[model samples]
Target: MPLTGYTIPRSPTGRSSLVPYPPWHYVGDFLVVEYWADPDKAVTVLPNGLDPHPDAGRCALVFADWQSCSDAGGELLDPSRSQYKECFVVVNALLDGEEVTTCPFIWVDRDFALTRGWLQGFPKKLGSIWVTRTFGLDSPADPGVRAGARFGATCAAYERRVAEATVTLERISETGPTHNDPPIVNVRHFARLEAGRHDEPAVHELARSRSRDRIVSPVWEGVATLSLYGAEHEEHDLLAPVRVGKGFRFTFGYTVDDQEIVKDIRS
Candidate 1:
């Protein structure tokens, strides 16, 4: 007899996993803004093994409208299963003596995205996200072809807004890659408390993951205006912007190749 297909079990139970595979595709619009925060306050929120970068209190706020598909080829056109929006506040941190970026806070609107992010160790929550842009329909020969865009997000819980940001971009200029920026890294931690567990949590684990490129194209440079509000969650307080940096937009895709489990914090 010949095999047709394999039946794999879902994780947290069986050996099969949705990650560590290919054909994950993502198309989205991103509005990324860099800012400065208090180093002391920033350090307090990072996970056990990560530290804030010393070269100023640098951070990035990202607003994205995402259409993502995984494990299924030619399925990108279907929005019913693979459409979501995200807002993330990431800070520059040092991991194992190397400078990297770590997301301390993030919010998304879709359940599938929420589960995927949680399984990958991202502290993701539910929120509303939106992005609007103005495009000029000028002739191809016209100097100004593409106009600017705006990005906004509201982190809400129980129908109440916890955090929000409104960002506007006036113009965009394409730019080359700069080597000064650090690589993006993430710290994942998960735990569960069982009924019989008394001394500590029943399960505690920590891991690290990063994006493996499909491609990064069309880096743009521009000016932006940002207003951030963090009233509902104290964690949002660390994202207060002291100085705003240039705005940039780019498109990139990658596969979730693998992650390394660095520590097991179950005591």
Candidate 2:
């Protein structure tokens, strides 16, 4: 068989011709809150070849309002073109004796974001995400500079609710790191068919750099309350928060540039 040479447009006209590119840029406000869970429960959800760090009972919940674009300049032209929201849950774990984080569940509101995330190996599902901020009014004598923020997210699969949570914060202050945690690691799973003959599923353990190509303009910490709901999907039970930890909010932007795949999971 002979092949024809043709130019593939950067912005393909059809869905079937879409190509995934790197340096994906996103500008967003996010809330990152950690919670304490049963240590035994945390270990159970991890995929094969990953283990929870001994004494690793921490779960982090993130709510993000994203204005994402394929390139840096596209964001300023029309920020609303690819605006979306996402919420995800990750737990501290160990991979090959190194501390890492594992995301067992996540939800996003946009289809393009969902598809892009899946290509990156995130366990992302479609759902609704809402975040709100309220400022407190101060009297003339006293200058009040505090505000409250609320985050809510719900995920459904096959017409059933899989997981949902509400997090509220009354006060936030710009502060330093309250705790030192390891970089995030994800179980990336995708399938590839080569030459329409060879089919194989890839499951890799990927780690993201903690400080590269990421901008945290201002990081704020606050006290928060978390309320988790029951789930129709049993896998989500691993995320049920038993105790609350520190709450944080930040304005962040990042370019997806450096990621190391530690190992591949074959089983």
Candidate 3:
């Protein structure tokens, strides 16, 4: 889907966000994510590793999104489900109006018919995931060539050749022959993430209730409103209300009006 809206990252300095975003591409047929950082912000990836991505330094917020690299890439999303929209919404929430470049992405099933399967990763790679941006290929080849690399005895050399080659792919259309060329999907990175507290706990009451099964409950003191999180759920149509009536009053369960006491726990 085309990105229709743009929101400025809510940075006090009006610069970047509290966090930095990193580079990640999907690998399922067309679910691959291939992206780069701004020239100044990006770090060149060495060829020693099979996977390549930029390093997000110390920052509070991180950017994230999924992309479709092939024609079938769009099928994995059930936008009708809450999770899909929530995924983007969550990424946005974490960013808090920070600029995050999420390339439009896609996903396809394991065997969507193409005359070629990426051969370098085949048999073992087939039915698995393959990124459109070849790790070493000068350009991504057709399914035939990618799948053809499977028959060589010097498999390691074949892999290194494929990895070093510049990436290529067909157009990410729903139904079109694999194009001879593919675009370098560029997702913008803004911040680096240092894992820390998203939320914290304030202990209100850590009371012990003695029962055969050991039912221990704690009261949590939250901001402004004291909210409770852990409580037993009753299954049989649990709809009950606080009952009040004449000659009755609401107070602590065991109490005489206007008197409060803190009993010794030793009892």
Candidate 4:
């Protein structure tokens, strides 16, 4: 009930920064899902933040674990930490068909917001990622069922909410986009749910910090299966991925994704 009425705010490059559900797929007998990932290989501008990933040498998914499920605490604290909303639910989704099999949820956000990450102890730039997000769910350690579900899942739902299409960057070519490196995926990448677990209830967890986080509430709280509540421009600094291409405006590579409706940022 509460999840249905929520609306994504509106404003453009207006950066507030940061922000899944799926079909009958299930995880440990409960949940719903969705996520993003790289669609192609990046030759890699630098290797410090792009060291040899565990999924190296093969086509695998990449995941960004921003916070641990156990550490999520309290209602998420807003910019001022005054207002608060308890967590809603932990979700999972299935991977939509892609040019590649890479899953972005293992280590990334549904919005593709770049956060702190490392290869060794070194930092990483956001440009090095090479995957697109997909959504689905199933029992622990089991690949989620593509269609209907029976039982034994950690959490499951009846519907998978993927966008009209999966977004990808394309080179200016008559055929398609190309990259220098091969795509990789996260073999250990599994859909994790951090949600309310109830139809009309809300919950929040303590989000972990690097060094004794002084936050009164969770920064991210936990993982979620997100859908486009709709685009908004909260802070002017936040920019959409769309830009000019030749004479046509380009954002996502495919027509389906490009037409999903986004808040065009203006200067």
Candidate 5:
């Protein structure tokens, strides 16, 4: 018997697998808040190869509602596999004199999204994420994208609230956040299960995002507030904000075709 080309739970139709092979297409609406944290605490969370950024401790908490589909486009018809909510922590870091972003923590509402993230070196966990939805209708709750409009988002894991953010739209921004333009770097690490290989990982490397066909909407900037909660088994407090910066809301789309390895240290 033969199996599928990629992913597990292979079958004749490959329907049992969680994620399919790229190119994966995603479009998402996002609410992001920028902040600065304690540089000392940040150093402990970043990976070894990454150095602290010059303007150290700069970070962003992003809340997104997304719809994704593969090249086949079959998943688009199945909402269960195509739609998800996500929240993540992005930290600025430097790798060989080049500025890049790294995600130290992330949470999603679906399993497929988690697996897809792991493949790209994102440490994604299961959590409940919610982002305020806006509409074009003329109603009190359905606020339009304009000055004075407010947006709220929250993330919770293990039945504990992890973080929350509120952004009040002040004006339309001509340019989006520049800090996020840097290529995202991630540590792709997979531990081995063999008895003798317990001390080593089967795959350990640094990879950069290779997404293409990017499209972004007009960004909205505003005043914002953020709060991070500490929990028994979680370290969300490590990146607590020292100074909260501006907030932004936008929509963007990109395609995940592949990844480029920047470092390989498999042993």
Candidate 6:
């Protein structure tokens, strides 16, 4: 029989054991906090050949509840494979004279999400994420979408709390959130497995996410607070916010099938 597979642990079936082939569709509700971090510290996390945004060192900490499905849409029926949560930090930077955003750190709760993120150049790891959920009940226990409503979220890994954020909805935004509006840039890096080829990576390049059918819901912006805690193995604290800005809550959807390689380091 001819071998067939798109990813690891291949079987006679071409389907990947982890995640199916794209175009993967996603719908997510997010709580985002925008802030400025130490410019010097922020620059340290950017991949080589990129520079910090000339205006300021801006970063957005995002907590998301996501539902994803492949083109076949079978995963939607199998909820286990389609639902997950994530937390990530995106920093604004300059790539080849153009403004771009890069994800320096990210954590997801599902193995499939983690593997999928790796393929897209996001360095995703396992973490527990919790976000305040809203309900439709007309009672105090259920928070409604309106002024004075507060939302909170937290992310932790290896039993260590990494970050926390709180946002109090003050008003609806007409222009939407600005923190993550730029094109996303990421570095795809995979080291060679052979001991002798340790210095050379199998893949090392700058990539931009190419997502279609993007949609954004009405955004809610308000006062916000964020705190970052340093863990023994995590360096995210280095990007701790120097000045916290507006907080936003929004829902968005998009489809991803491919990426654009901006530069190949090894070429």
Q: Candidate 3: what lDDT?
A: 0.18
Which whole-number lDDT from 0 to 100 does residue 223 have in model 2?
69
lDDT of 5 by residue, 1-267 (tens): 666745777887777777898899999999999998898887778876789899888888999999999998998888998999999988899999899998888999999999999999999999999999987887998877989999999999999999999999999987767655688998888888999878799888889989899998899999999999998878968999999999999999999988999988663
Q: Which residue segments of model 4 deviate by more than 4 Å?
A: 1-57, 62-72, 76-267
**TM-score of every candidate:** 0.76, 0.75, 0.14, 0.18, 0.96, 0.96
lDDT of 6: 0.90
Scored by lDDT, the top model is: 6
Model with the higher lDDT, candidate 2 or 4: 2
> Stretches of candidate 2 above 4 Å error?
1-20, 75-80, 133-181, 191-211
Which 10-residue span in candidate 6 carries the lowest summed lDDT? 2-11
lDDT of 6 at 16: 57
Worst ten-residue run, lDDT, model 4? 253-262
lDDT for each residue of candidate 6 in 1-267, tens digit (9 for 90 to 100)? 876655676777876578787789999989999999998899999997677798557999999999999888999998999999999999999998888899999999999999889889999999999998877567887666789989999999999999999999999988766777889999898989898998899999889999999998789999999999999989999999999999999889999999999888865
Give the Cα lDDT of each candidate. Answer: 0.63, 0.64, 0.18, 0.20, 0.89, 0.90
As a whole number from 0 to 100, the lDDT of residue 108 in candidate 5 is 97
lDDT of 2 by residue, 133-201 (tens): 323455444323244444454555555665555544455554533322466667677665667634556
Each candidate: RMSD: 5.2, 5.4, 29.3, 21.3, 1.3, 1.3
Q: Model 6 off-target regions past 4 Å?
A: none
Question: Global CA lDDT of candidate 1, please?
Answer: 0.63
What TM-score does candidate 1 get on C-alpha atoms? 0.76
